[model samples]
Structures are given as C-alpha cells and as structure tokens.
Target: MNDKLDLQSTDITAMNIDKIAVLFPNCVTETAEGKKIDFDLLKQELSTEIVEGNKERYRLEWPGKREAIVTANIPTTKTLRPVREDSVDFDTTENIYIEGDNLEVLKLLQESYLNKIKMIYIDPPYNTGNDFVYKDNFAKSGGEELFESGQIDEENRKLSPNPKTDGRYHSDWLSNIYPVLKLSRNLLKDDGVIFISIDDNEVHNLRKICDEIFGESNFIGCITWKHTQQSKNDERFLSRQSNYNLVYSKNILITKNFKFNRTEEDNKNYSNPDDDPKGFWRSGDVRSPNLRQTLKFQIIAPNGNIINPPDNGWRWSEEVLKNKIQSKEIIFKNDNSGIIRKIYLSEQEGRTPENLWDGNVFGTTRIANSELKELFGDNVPFDTPKPTGLIQKMAELFRTENDFTVVDFYSGSATTAHAVMKLNAEDDGNRKYIMVQLPEASDEKTEAYKAGYKNICEIGKERIRRASNKIKEEKIDKAKKDGLFSEFKDEQDYGFRVYRLDSSNMQDVYYKPQDYNQGTLDLFADNVKEGRTAEDLLTQIMLDWGLPLSLPIERKTISGKEVYSVAGDSLYCCFDDGIDEAFAKEIAKEKPLRIVFRDKGFKDDTAKENVKQLLKQLSAGSEMKVL
Candidate 1:
C-alpha cells in the first residue's frame, strides 16, 4: 500500500497505477528488491505522450527540480507528537498549531485531510536573496537519488540561504517550493482554493508553477493589494508598494460560482428612504457595458419626458423595463436625467470581490506593525507581518460556506489565525484553522529573542493568544452594548491544540518489520520507544487511523484500567499495559464505529486470541485496529 492512505482513504496514485496496469500488464513489473514501480517500463508503455531526447516540448527546468520531485514522494516513519503544555486547549478545540518541517507535515496530513480542506493560504519566502529555503535530500533517507538538485549531496540535512550571487538563484527557490505545493494539492477538496501571498521576488516563478500544478484553466484572478502607502526613498529604481495573491481552485467547476463574503460596508450603501416594503434599497445600474441593439430602447421619465438609452444601451429589454415600472421598482433621478432599478438589501447574497484592493479597506503594513507593537508591548518581532484584515478578505472570498478548514503552512506571526477568529466573531462562523510553522530559531540579537521568544513558532503562538484575548474582550463589550448577553454563549473555542512533528513513538525495528521475527520481538520486549507516553502513542494511532487529532477525548477507567473515547464514542482506544480481556469485552459492548488496542498489551497469546474473537462477535462492522 502507498504510505499516505489509511484503510479509509482511496489512494489516488495507487488507483491510477492500477488503472494503468490494467491497460499494460508488462509495465507493472516490480523492482528486484522492493516491489517499487518500474517507471522506465511505464514510460516505454506510454511512448506517445512521453517526450524524450531533446524534444521541443515546453517545460519548467531548474537545477534541483528533479530532487524536489523526489522529496515529496519519499516515505517517512515520522508522526505528530502531542505537546499539551504548549497548547491552549489540547482536547476540546478544533484549531491546531503544528511545529515542524512543513514538507513532513504535508505528508502526515495526506490521509486525514485528503479532499477535506476547504481553503489554504500561505505566505512563503519570496526568494529575496537573503531568504532561507528548505532543502530535501532523498538520498539522505537511504533512497537512491532518483532526482538531482545540484546544491546538495546525500549527507547534509539543513536549510541554507539562497544568495543572489549564486548562479542558480531562481532555480534554488523553485526547488524549495515545488514539492511542498505538489504535496499540498492532494489535501484540497474538489472546489478548494489556495491563495499564495507573494511579491515581485518570486511572483512570476510562483505563477508558472501554479499554472502547471493547478492547470491554467483553474487559475483564479491575481489580486493586487496595496500593502503600504509610504515611498521607500532608499530604493534605486521604482519603489515597490504592492504585493499579490495568486489564487487557484483545485477544480473550478465544482465551485458553482465565485463569491465574496458580504461585508458591513457593502450593506451600508442601502437605505430605506422611500421604502416600498422591500426593506433597505439601493440603485442598481440599469445600463451595462455590453452592446445589444435589442436592449437599446427609450424610456419615459417620471415627468413624462423622453430619456434615451445609455452609451452601450440598456441592460434590460423593453418588456422587463415596462414590468419594473408597473411594479414600482424603478426610481427616477430628481434631476430628470436617467432612471435607476431597485436592488433590495434582503435579496443580496454578496458582491464579487474585485481584483484590486486599496490600503484603507485592508489595513496597510504600517497599521499591521502598529498592531504588533501594541500586542507585544512595543516589541515588533516580525519584519513584514500581513494585516489580519487583508488575510480576512481572502478567507471571506474563498469561504463558500459557514464552516470550513483553512491551512497555512507558512504561518509567520499567526496573523491568519487572528483573522479567522475575527471573522468568526463578526459573523459567528465556525471556521477552523491549522497553522504549520517550522521552529526556525530566532536571532539572538533580535528583539524577539530578547523578549524570551526562542523561535519564530514561539512568537506566532504568543500572537494567537494575545489576539484571541483581545477579540474576546471586544466581543464582550459589543454584546453588552447590544444587550444580547443572554443570547451569547461563552463556550466558543478561542484556543488551539498544538502538535509537533517528531520521530515516531515506535522503535526502528517496528518500521523495519521485515527484519524482526517472533523471537526478535521477545528480545525487544517493548516495541514502543522510551520516554513516550500512552497519550503520545494514542495520538500517532489517531493519525494512522485517519482520525482528526483535534477531536475531543474522554478518558475513563473501565475494568480498573484506562481507556479513551474520542468525540463521544465515535472511536475507542486503550493503549494501557497489561490490559485485561474483560476490559476489551466491555469496550466492545459500546459498539463504537472504530476501536484500537495495543498489539502487545495483552497478557499472552490466549488473552489476545480471546478478545480478538469476542470483539469481532460483539462489534460487527467496527474498524478494529492494533498498534
């Protein structure tokens, strides 16, 4: 089986491989050692589509492009380790903060999050010469270097700064970004969209890859945002004042249509001046820019004067205009120049978010910096954190429903998390956010380190805490003023569960199960590694079973031993030592949809054999699993 999928998920790659094998049986031969796919044979089979020997086909080439390709496909025995101390509300919250290499996190998320994410937004390094990029060397993981990036050998594992002085400056950045994006695409829902914030440094390069990965047809509009108003006098050429969000949908056809969340400012345009019982009303343009000779008709003014069609003619036909006039839905200008149509506020769903955004609507960089200083007691740690307002706009644009998941692999100062909370408070949305940030060490000389923030992840988590509290206080004031205290509940989650990508709780022998036998297992005694708790093992199992880690957990003593129930008995688990058969039988009585047990926790073969049979009989159709 491909490592990405649990028994629950259908591995698309595997499915495709099977489909290909059905058409060409000879191309399905396995490698001599590992039963891996023979890509050479597959390429030979698909000779028509295959381009080789310096053909004139267009392709995006970089020094390390092949290595990046290999990086995403390489398998790992890694798992997410629960860090309850670092978390705010570890058990009850839906939001999660993952501290690790994003590439690995992307891999781990494949099964549980596949076709589940509603939207994604990331602001990655822009290849600004001094910026650092992740280098994934597959050879270091003991696999043959199937791909090559001229930068590294099979030894080192570290992030290096891609200096502009290097010959392969752009190539290095492409190598860094390509694989992560390819892997991230697997997690997106069919209608899911991704918004990447980038500047001139890598916007063109990013766009090229996005077009390739998401397909040119699925490309959404590139939104240009005015990030700042002040001119940088130090620039030698034209001063940079804006950034862009390259948007793309996983599959555009599934979206039905694009929409932006209706904002208060958008609704404020309507007023009930001469209300005809349609609530608040605003004038809609009756004339469109589309030319249609059929729609070019004259209309009689309220004063019985003739009014001519607009430059491009009318948006409605003469019949529709006559019906509007009869229904009292048309408004005439007091100056007797033109007529307008009524657009009732109650009928409006949302306005289309235009491609251009000014600084005033979404707060500028200056405002973001000021916000940081205020939250951090005058200590501005991050250099160019985006304003929450800006990210909120993007979130609202892609959010077609009230509840959805948003993942940000490059969550710098947790501004995106702040935006999620703010939007939720404003509209009572149940949006969940997942923030992944590498624990990039903070510079010792910087104010962040001086303020006791040891790494970027620390600063980001702290920002979320501060932002959450501030939003809560503001909401309390609003509720008090509106006299809606009784209607509001204080139970909403403003906290997150935290997990770190760490080595698996299982020993090396467990991953390399082929090397171990029944006698070897006796010699090893305990399969789980030392210094790992039952909870840690439980978390790894949860992920392996394709269960979400954010589900609420309930621990109880059944038959005088510990057992865990997740999300109200949807899944049951017990990883305790010397677990009794009676306890297993008791758990099976609940008949949860899924159940898990430690493979070695049983007293002996008889104990294990008895419960295995009892569980099968007691809980038919349940997904029974063992660690």
Candidate 2:
C-alpha cells in the first residue's frame, strides 16, 4: 500500500499522553480511545500525600469545564481552503487571513505554527450582556433556546448573546473562551506573549482562567488603558472610562522584561550637561524597589562626606556600588544631600512599559471610531474597533523582531493586520500577520449590510485591503514629497493570503477505506471530493504534512502533468491523473525533498511499481506519499 496522507489536525491529547507515559508509565492506562492519562494515578504520582477520591483542589471551575478541556484536545477534520479571489497576494505573501471559527482555526495551526508565533493580540467578546458570545455546543447543554433565538449561522456556529439574566452567564462565557485559549497557547514561541483586551464585565473571571491556563508565575501584568477621558455621567455609580489588557507570556523565564520604543519625549530628560564621554545621561533613582538590609550601608563621597541610603536601601550591593562610584556612574549632589545615578542614554535598551496606559499615547475608542470613519467614510461598517496604535504599542512593548509573526484570532475589523503593515512601513521591516475571524452575518438594518458587506469577515477583509492601499499611498506620497521616491522603494509586505476553513478535500472513502467492501470499491475510485481542485488538494496536503499555509507556491507543467512546487523544492505535489515512469523521473531529477502523488493516477499496478522504483533510484532521500 502507498503512503496515505493523514488529513486531520494534530492529536494533541494523544501526544500529551505519550509524553506523560515516558515520565510515568504507571499513570498511563488503556481506554476505549487507546492510551489515556489516568488522572487519579497522575495525582498520586505528583503529590507526596495520599490521593483520595473527589478531593478538593484550587482551580477555576465552571459547569462545562470538563467539556471545554475535552473540546480543546479533540482534533478536527476541517481544512483551510485558499480563497484566491478574496486574497491580496495568493502565492507570494507571507501573511495570512483566515475566515472561520477561531477555535477550529487555532487547532489547525497547532502543528504548522507551534512555538513559532512571536506575539498574539485578541479582543474577544467582553461578555457585556449586549455583546454576543460564542455558543459552543459543549458550552451549553441545550440548543433549543439558541435555535429559537435565531443566532445560529449558516455553518451552524452558535452565536448567542449572554444576558446577565441567564443563570449560566459566567459559566457559558468561560466554556466559550477556555478551549480557544488552550489551543492558542500551543502556538506561542518560548518568548512569545499574548495580550487580551477586556472590560469590567468579565475581567475577574478572565484573570482567574488566565492564571490557571498560563500559570500564575507567567502572569505579566494588567494594563489599565484609559480609553476615553470623558466620563459617562449617566452611569449608576462612578463612570467607567478604562478597560483592562491582561498580558501573559508562554514562558516567564524566557521573556521577563517588556519594553516600548523610546520616543523623543522619553529621551528629553537625558542631556550631556557635563559632556560625559559615555553620552547623554539622566538621573536615576538609587533607591531599591524592595527592602534589602545588605544594601542599606552608607556611602562615603569623594569629598569624605557621608551619604545616607534611601529608606528601602540602595539598588545595588555594597561591592557593586563601589564599582559604580569608581566608574563615576554614581555622583554626589553639589549640596551633598543625595546621590544621583547617571543612567547613560547610550546604555538604555528601551523605555520600560508602564502598567497604566494613557488614552493620548495609546488610543481611545473615539480615535478608533474616527479611524473607521476615515476608512469607510460616513457609513462606518464595524463597531467598537480598536485603534491600530493600541495593537502597535503592544507589539513594541514585546520588542517585536523585524521579521516576527503576529496573530489575532478575534480579528475584529482587522486592526492587527493594519497595525502590522503600519509598523512595517514605518521601520521598513518585513513582519507577517495572520487574522482569523468568524463570518458572522451583519444585521440587515446596519449600514455595513446596506453597503453590500454581508458579514463581519467581509468588513474585516475590506478593512485590510483599504488599510493596505492607504498605507502604501501614504508611503509613496511622503517619499515623493521628500524627493526620495526613486530610492524609497519599500519592500515590506502589504498583502495577505486568504484562506477559509472548510471540510477536508478528501472524500469519506479516502479516510475510511476499511469500511467499504470490495463490492463498493469501484465507487471510491476518485478519493478527492467532486468540487475540489488541484490547488485545494495541494493546500490540504501541505497542512497534513505540517507545512505553513503561507509558504510560496509555484505551479508548472512537467511531462503534460501539472505539478506544484512549494517553497522551491521544500515540497512538490502532483495530484494530476495518469502518472507514469517518465513523469516520475522528471520530478525526481529536481531532487525534491518531499513528493506526493495521486494513488489512482498511475496507469496500473506495474506502472505504479516502476514509478516508485524510478523515484528511489533518482532521488533516494525524497519522501514520497500518496493521496
């Protein structure tokens, strides 16, 4: 039998069980689904004390917690189909835009993007009663009310509003987000970080789950973003003008320091008053942040005047302080009142990000609305859009690399894509982005719907296109105005490849051949779906092989058969019918690292054996697979 493609998302649950089996074989037991982790045995192995039945533990629990966990581990048969008509650059662009349920999208990305993303930013439903929350099947027990409420999409995705009156309001919201977040965690690099925006409605519950998911030690900090200076005086009590941004890292040890790009204002305090050879310097506080008895000793100035340490003590140790004085880093005031530590501008890495972000610096909701108004004109399409500045600031705080990858699952209005392009245009970097959004229908009465934008995904895709054009035009205008048009050729990527999640390209018989008897074998001649194209098969094959969907694809005809070359020989695919020895030899001569073919494409059994032997002789290292 030829090698068949395993067309499904990664089996994360099985992988985890295997990992545990290596460490604790006794904790791994057989179940109906093969090998599974025995939680009772695992607990006993992890704890020093005796583990009993139904023991109480500290955890964030809801009605459907177990279901939520199970949902995250279950692999999906879904695949991402490329949409060339909706895409900006279908073949060459490294960026991606997927229209689908983010939970399924995240699961599909586990193998291809595991530990690869540099940053992630999400603005999920705040569960503010009015906002619609994702109504996962496991998130709620019954679906009659949801169906009657008329919130299910054409694809059967439930989108129900979580009113405060509902008894399972909090529990439903928890179940909805828990699985998506769990899957998202697997895609982050060791030094990667995720920033989630929320409001007062569910911030408490959000933090509890985040602490449980990312671990308490990995909790970075919560930023209080003052979105609007004006207060809502009509509120029952005090006005709520700010929202919270909860930041977390994949590994705290890998990414401990978060900083933002230093601005002109940030560097204004630094000056070369004494013309120090090191460079412009600013006075830094010598006091320690926490109490340290060993660093509380007094220091003798060069003039023999004793200088007392601050209340908490010095920032550096006595030996380090002596080194600093010798290096002239610590200087005494002319009045001998206190010591001033000279922090050189040249030595400063970047401005340390603050927990409190002001509206003027970050962005306000009003600013975000204005941005949408400018892009879409009088009839804005989306509501509650986040300004590009806010997302850009998060990337800067993470100290994003020039070629870093950013993902936004809840990509409302595609602001994250807009920000990535904006940052690249400003710095001439080649950053990439992936924006995944659900195709939630727009209300008929809404202006967006009236403007022919049928769903939220339409608005998001149009937003990115409009934003990309605007950014490119602005860059050209500035370059021309400054008389540097010829030399100012920006090579940054301002395009994205569009993909929509759908059912696998393969037919049922391809996955379950054992179920079909010899009598029904003739019906399964063509394993692929009827409407599927060559590109669709190649895309799914790439995903099944753990290849990124954004990789460059080149198509060419060899020996009268159309073949796809992915990333220039990283992978070669030929789903065409009628494969023969000549075609196989022609393909193998290219020395492709991996090759795939259609099993039924060969002329006969003898022909298939000849092609296989030819490939082995021509390209010994090329891994061959069949569909």
Candidate 3:
C-alpha cells in the first residue's frame, strides 16, 4: 500500500498502459480518447503545504479537596422569602432595590443571568482616609465568638477604614474588590460596557485591576466630569473640581457601534436660506485635497473676476462642474461672501461624536444636589448623587428605547434607576436596571441617620419612591395645564419592582432518629414562620428532583384540602393535610407523570396503598412518592 508506483521518466508507448491500468485500476486515471493529460497542470493545482496537527491536551485535576471544610460553631442559617407581595409595586416597574451583601447577590445571579446585562455603572466605596471598610470573612474560626462579639451585628455593623499607616492598606482594598469585579465582568454581554465613578483615591489601582479582568484591549477612554462648582481646602495648589469616570467595554468594536443622539440645538444649525428643494441646507467648502485631486481649476465669477482655488484643488473636476451647471445643483450663497456653496442637509452625512464631554449639556454636582433637594425637600439623606440629566445623556448615547438593560451595582440612593425611569418616561423606553448595595447601616454621627434612616438601603428605597411620586406629580401638573389629562384623573407615569438577595431555597430535610430533638423542632418551627410555606418546602423537593426552579406552580383544592402542583403537567403534591382516597383517585384520574404526598399526612396505610394501586391501574405512567 505504501509502494511508490513510478518516479523516473517512462515511455508510455513502450509500456502496456491498459495492462498497467488493470494491475492498479484505482490509482490509474485515463483522459478522453486521443487527448493528452497534463500531469504538470494537475501537480501545480494539487501541491499544498503540509502543516502539523494540533495535539490533544488533558487538564490535570488537583489531588486535594477543591473546597475546605470548617466547623461552624455558631448558627449562620438565614431565611429569605420573596418580597413581591410585601413591596406590591415591585416587578411591575423597571427599577430594582436589593438589600444584602452585593457579592452574594451577584453570585446567585450568575446562573439565571450571565452575559445578559447591557451596562454596569458602579460607584464603590472610595477607600478614603475615613471611609467605611468592609470586613470579608469567607472562612473563619470561632464563629460563636465572632457572632456574639457583635462582629456580624445586624443593627451596628463594623466599618474600620484602612489607614495609610496600616501595612496592608492596598492589599485589603484589593481583596475586597477582586471577587466582585470578577463576577461583575461575567454579567456583561459581549457588547456590554461598564462605567466606574471614582476619585483620585484608587482610580489608578482600579484601572489596573479592571485591565486585568476585562482585558487591556477593551479599555475605553476615561471621562472627566466636572463634579463641583467650587473647590475648598486650597492651601498652596488649586483644588480639583473634576472626578474621573473610567470606561471599558466588553468589546471595543461593539462599543463603537453606539450612536450619539443629536439635540434640537444641533439640528437648528442647518438652515435652508436658499430654499433649495432638499429640506435644509448648510454651507461647506468646495475644495478637497484627497478625494478631488484631479478637480483643480480656476473659477471665473459672474463679474468676470478670476479666483484662485485652494492650494490642494477644487472639490470637483471641470467635467463635473459642467454637469452641475447644466443641472443647476450648485448654487452660490450670495453675490458677496467669496461665493460660498450650499450643502443641503439631506446631502450631508451624520457627524461622529467627539471625546470631550461638555458640562453645560450635562450638569455639575451642585446642580444635581439642588435638583434632588427641590424634589425631596431640604435635608435629603444622600450627600452626593449624579444628576438625572447626566445619566439620561448617557442613556441617549448608548441605549435605545426597549432595547437595553442598565445595571448599577453601587446603587447609592438608586439615582441610576431614577435616571433610567426618567429617560423612559420621556421617550417610553423600556430600559431595566439591577441595583446592588451592601446593607450598610447609616452612620449615627451623620445627618442622614438623624433624619430617621436606618441603613443606606432604606434611604435608597425611599429616594426611589419619592422620585417616582415626583415624576407622576410633574406629569399630572403638566397634563392639567395642557388640558390633555383632565379626564384621566390619575396620571402617574412611573413604577418599580424591588427584589432582595438571599440564599437558595433548597434545604436537606433528611434526619436520623437520634438527630430529631427539641432543637430540630424549634428550628423547623422558625423556618415555617419565616414565610416558608408548604409551597416553599415543595419547591425544595423540586430542587432535589433536579427540575427547573422556574416551573409553573398551581394551587387546587382536592378532597377539602389544598394541593400545590408544579408544571400542572407533572409532579403533583398534597402537602397541606391528610390525603384521602377520593383525592388520590382524582389525582390518578388527572394522570400526572409523578405524584407526591406528605408521609405524616396520610389517614392510614390503607389509604397510601390504595393510592399506589389506583395509580398503577389507571395511570401506569405515573410514579408515587412520600416526603
């Protein structure tokens, strides 16, 4: 099979070609009768480079355990219930108010929502001289001592700023931020972007860390926003009035696709003084250096005056000029101003945006705070919040109506969401926001706490409520004055849905006889009161079944008892009370794929046996189990 057939020159007439073809029929090829086959042409076409194939590689697994096992001396179990009913207005609106550790919330969101966010704007703690420090204790010993010593106090939390004198100041800050930034990057889509608001305290470090996470190629330019009108505490040098917004993109090419919206002022620049049939007109130079190289010519005005063209050349050639003169497409602005040409707006191309951001178009922080105060009366809890106009401008630049998702992880006072709502109110855009904030207790020493605010989350929620109310009020007042909404009565235009963060609903219910005692019953009772309804326990069972958590749940009264069924097509359960024969027969008649019942809720062993038999006879495809 590996033998070489022929190498040196061979005489085809001397050899019996037909006999040789028979000997190696598959390898031989014959051309049309009496036509010569060009072997050289075939060889030239078939010649190719031989490249080495890539090798198959295997990853080595670590021999040690991937996670550590530490004895938790104190109880750290928490109960998290859905706050949809409590908040009432949440989910129907576009805003979100999350209360918990942002890190944990971000992790929980990894599965259901990776690569789904459009934009993420975070204003994390600046790590100033007296700024609050977050204590990260992922793994610790003496949990009881830590809990009892008020280390994890719900009311009075710990916040020790990293002093410059501390040896691990930078290390501590990096440790606090690395995990969050890593997770936040996962939430961004391939075309998503991030805007980080930071001061001089850690802007440089933040950029380096972001580069490592989002790749240096994705680094967008930093925007310098004029944050203050006047700067104080100037001894020698001038006080800085601007703060930096570090921008980066998931992909630079994707971000470049974002278009800037033109304002009415920009549109007014184009005028149709000549009344050219092309809608609007503007003046443009009639010379070019690159595109019209061959168009250089001297122009003789109507007054018989000769005019020299630009150094480069005229924008059109003599042939093109003769064609325009015949068509009357070219017009001189007036008899005076050096014969300026008219360029119609319809003929003009769209302008690309410049990098420089104007403070007048957006606004300063003083104006932002004043606006906030006007909306929420004097002495608002939030000290510094971005103006709604600033965020609205960003939205106009990057987002379109009903097309983008905006996220603000460092949602101080929920200003980002407020801005999104305001923009949507104007243009009816469906931009959604996901806000994450640590439940940091408000400082008693600060005026915010003295105003009766408990934590930053409380202040954020209240701000959203007040902003929504104010927007509605303004809309109503405008509608009344315009006589457009006199018959409407209610003219509210803004609403929001709020969600809090917590642990997974799954809990191991299996316990040995020896482990069932008063303490276990007490724990179970506490879980029941914490809004852990029968439906909640059944959801835990569904998790154990490896079913999707978003399965549809239906409640039905069977045999004078409530039963929760998931998917309504399979997995029916009666967890409320004693299961009766009539209910079992009815469930069997429905013919679900799987049926479950509470083991302790059956009237007798006969009732359970009757259910199993009925399912086997009438619905042979069903499987029954007890919890």
Candidate 4:
C-alpha cells in the first residue's frame, strides 16, 4: 500500500511540472555567469512584494469612495461656441464645465489625456472652519446623490467646517486630496507644472503629500502671495496676511526648457538714443575688480579740463575703455560733471523674472474682485477670485498657444476657465480649460447667497455666461466700427458644454420567460426610447466596455434606422422588427469587432440566420450580444 501511494504521488508531481512549464514558457534559463535563473521563482518573489505593498497601503488608507460616474459621452451642452454665419470654421473650441465629482472625472480622463496637460492650478477648500467637506457617498443607487440633487438649496445643504477638534481632521483632508493629486500628476506632461493654493493650516501637510506624489526631485520654489494687505487687530497673536502657493513639476529635468516671459513694462525701460546700430541695449556697471583694478582714472572733458573719477574706478579695463572710445560708444555729459554712455534697447537680451511679483502688474485679489464687480453688477457672488493677469503670467511661464491643456479641478467661480478664455481671446490662441466644481449650495446667511445665488455651480455658470456675452458684445461692436465685418454673425459666442455625472445606461435585462412581468417590459421599452438615436446608446456601451472615453464615433442610417459605430469597431443599433438580411449584410460590410443589437430588432428566424451569415462573410471574429 505505501509503494502504491508513492507511485501516485510521483505521477501527481510530474503532472504539476508539466502544467507549470505550459504556464511559464521561460521559467528556466541559463545565465552567462554560469548560474541558473528561475523566472518562476523571481515572479513569485515579485508577486509577494506587490501583495505586501498593497496590504501596507490599505492599512494606512482612510475609508471613503468617489461619488462620480466614469463615462465616455462628452457632454454636448458643454461645447457651446459662437456660430459664425459666413466665416469658415477651424479648430474645436474647448471650454469644458464638468458637473461631477472631480475625482472620478480625473480617472476618466487618464487614458486619453495622460502626460498632455501643460499646467494645473487648483484652489481647493482651505480646510478652514467654514469650508465644506467633500463627503463621498457612492452607495446610493442613482449615481452621485449630492450631484443628482441638481441645484442644492441653502436649507437642505450641509456645509460643515473641518474643525481641528475633530478626530479625523487632518486625515479627512489628506484622504480628500491624495487621490486627486495622484491622478492629476498622470495628466501632466514631462515638463508640466502645478500650482496649489493653500493657507498656513495645511501648508506643511500639503508639502509632504506633494513631495510623495510629484516626487521630491520635482519640487519647485514656494511662492508667498499677500492674500490680505491688512493685519486684523481682533487677533491676539500675530496676524497672518499671506498665503502660500506651492509649485511642483512632473520632471525638473524637462522643466529646464521653461523660460519666463519679459513683460512690456520691462521692455519699456530700454532705449536707443546713441544710434549705435546694435538694436536695443541696456546699460550695466562697466567696473569690475578683475577687469578694472585701478583705484582711480582721469577723464578729459570736451572743454579740455581734466575730470577725476569718484570713489569707484572706470567701468571697464584700459583696453576696453580705449576700444569703446575709438568706437564712439562713450558719451560725455553736457554739464561737464561726468561722462555718461548711451544704451540701446536693441542691443540687450531679455531679463529673467524675479521671485517677488508686485500687485501693480499682476493685480491682487482686490483688483480682481473689483474687475468682476465692474463686469457683472456691484454684488459679486464669490470673493478672492484670482486675477487674469496673474494666471496669464503663470501661463506665459509654462506654455503657449494650444500646445498644452490646463485644468482647474477645484475651480471656484470658474476663475481659471475665465482666465483661460481671456488669454485665448487676447492672443487668438486655442488653449483649452477643464473646470470642475461641486454643486454645493451657497450659504444664505452669507452675503452672496442672500443676494439670490443658490449654489456654487450656479455662480460658476453665470460667470462663464456673462464673460462670454461680454466678449461677444465687445467683438461685435469692434467689428462693426472697424468695418472689417464681411458676413460675420455673432450667434451666442461663449458657452461651455455641460456634462453631469451619471451611471451606465445599460439595464439588466436577462429576465426568465416565466418571471417576465409588466415592470420588466416597461423598463425595456423605456430603455429603447424613440427619437433617441443608436449613437447615444453606443456611447454608453463604450463606457461599459472600458474603452477609451475619447473614441471617435460615426453614424449611418440602415433600413431607415441610425446605426452608431465607435472607432470603426463597435456597432450599436436598435430598431423595430425592420432589421432584415440586406441591413445585416450592410452592417457586416463595415467589419466591426463587436455588434450589439436590441432583441426585438430582428424580424424573424430568417433575420437571425442572415446576421450570422453576414458576420461569417465580413467579420468572422466579430462577437454579437443583445441588450
């Protein structure tokens, strides 16, 4: 009996070895160092490490979930561009307003937009006592409950502050921000940069988190902006008047290509009075210890009187001085007190921007708010909106034209989108913006909501509307006055396509014949609504397929019904019993990889056979399913 058991065990061991060999073709290898390399062992070791790493990550993780649906359908309402009556259309204008939790939106954008963004600027909640916490609730059946509530009212809304007294105060903030930062990093190009606005409360935490997310090597300098000019007397301790903007890049090595733009103000200081024919030039001190070592030098005046140098010696070496004099580069002052040389603006290169940004050129929040009030009415909805000048300065430093896409996920009042629009309009450039804001209700107790605003998203949409209207009106007025209008029509110029987060449109319809009821039939009928084209359903199908969200779609009419195709591969269709042999043949001619159709679309048994035959003829590898 023991000998028989040993034989059986040997057979089992041999069978296991054969299975392993089939699973891992390169399991055994001989290294050049005369050592045996077991790929199977190496893979097992790596898998163990991965499992342990995942366990550690989960151990430190906070409990929360995203409240947004990742889908493929780009919101048609969000792409509102002014239609031209006569002028030829060119590029697609993108000023996107996504109505969803930004966390899911970031994930949805990961595939098509990885390493494509130029700059990301976020003005998240400051974690102050009044700031609303992002309570993610995904357990609800109908998509995101908070977002599905549409426009929230002040009475039903909850905007609690993240007080320090709370046990999970810091953890909550970290949980809310970690996934977002990690996802946003994927959207940044190699040289892409991000600027985060924060207060003293979470600056240290933000720095540590950013270092971990963006890599410590990618950290740039932190900029301190004077948020408030006045120091409050009500505070017992030192009053805080500044906020920090932490900057980081995807890769500092790639960021070396970035250059600061010289403003018009900086260029205005240069002049060309001497006409040295060297273009523009700027003056520099001519004296240096290595070049000019003499303690003093003598200068001969036009009147033949000898002028002694002051405490400082000559600006250049004796040889250089002789060369300048010979070339007539040096000039004598008319007063005979000293000799001054002319500097040409064309002769000098541009200067680098300094760390300190003055409020004059890049206006402060006060100026920005005042401008908003001027454009809209006296009562602005939100406070502390960043100025277009400031964003423009940053944009100039990072990118140009449509070369990069900019995102502001924590877009308060849509200021970053407004700035992007204004910048593009000024330069006729095609820089795109993706703005995401929660539909949190405004506080009726505060001055803003009491003035008739309901929620934060309402304010954002209104701002975009007003800004578009103003830009269109100005352009029309200018065109009319200049007589440059040759058939241009101003047809609602500025608008963004609006998309709200929602679940997959597919319904679970695998009902048994015995269990079929009126409710199931009603759901099926509702799913196949009339006037809704197949393209709409196909878009939702693509989302369910986990395909690229930005896939190009095309539509064609077959048997008087529209059949939608995505990426020339997936076909989605639905129609009443009119789908016949000819229709199936035409659809199969496209050679789709997958075909989806409504169960009731087939006319009879003959129609199903025709579909099978067409698939065999044109698309042999095609898979078919019924919704």
TM-scores of the models, in the order given: 0.80, 0.86, 0.66, 0.65
State which candidate has the highest TM-score: 2
Task: Give the per-residue lDDT of model 1 (tens digit) for 1-627.
Answer: 237745576757667766876887666533212123456667766687764544445766556667789988997679988888988977779999999888888988888798998889999988887765646433344333321332342234545676754545777678779988998898899989899989898898899898888898999889899999999999999888999999999998886466786778889888988857879998888886788888788888878889999988888888988888788788788877888789998887778778888889987999889889888977788877989999888777754576988899999999889899988888888999999998777777889989998888999999999988998888888888999977977655788988988888887754376877778877467778889887888888878877877788888888877888888878888877676677768887788888887778887778887888888888886777777
lDDT of each residue in 1-627, candidate 2, tens digit only: 339998999989778877898999877654423455779889999899998966668876667788899989999998988899999878779999999889888988998898999899999988878775656443454555544444764345567777764646777788889999999999999988999999988899899999988888999999999999898989999899999999999999988488777889999998988888999999988899999998899988767888888889999999998888789898778877778899899988888988999999899999999988989999999888998999888887656467889999999899999989998888877788999998877888889989998888999999989998899899999999999998987777777898999998888754365677876777678778899888888888888888888889999899988899999989999888789888888898899999998888888888889988999999999988888
Ranking by lDDT, best first? 2, 1, 3, 4
Error of 2 at 413 (Å): 1.1
- Residue-level lDDT tens digits of model 3 in 430-538: 6777677766667677667888977777777777777777777777788788898857454233554445554444344657888899878766542333445675566
The runs of at least 3 residues in candidate 2 whose Cα sits more than 4 Å from the true structure, single-residue gaps closed, are: 1-54, 136-150, 154-158, 288-319, 509-521
For candidate 1, give the lDDT of residue 277.
Answer: 88
lDDT of 4 by residue, 105-178 (tens): 67666655778788999988887755647452233343345433442222233334556545356656766787
Q: List lDDT for all candidates, in order.
A: 0.81, 0.86, 0.65, 0.65
Model 4: lowest-lDDT 10 consecutive positions: 78-87
What clash count goes with each model?
A: 0, 0, 3, 18
How does candidate 3 fare on TM-score? 0.66
Name the TM-score of candidate 4.
0.65
The most accurate candidate by lDDT is 2
**lDDT, candidate 1, residue 181?**
94
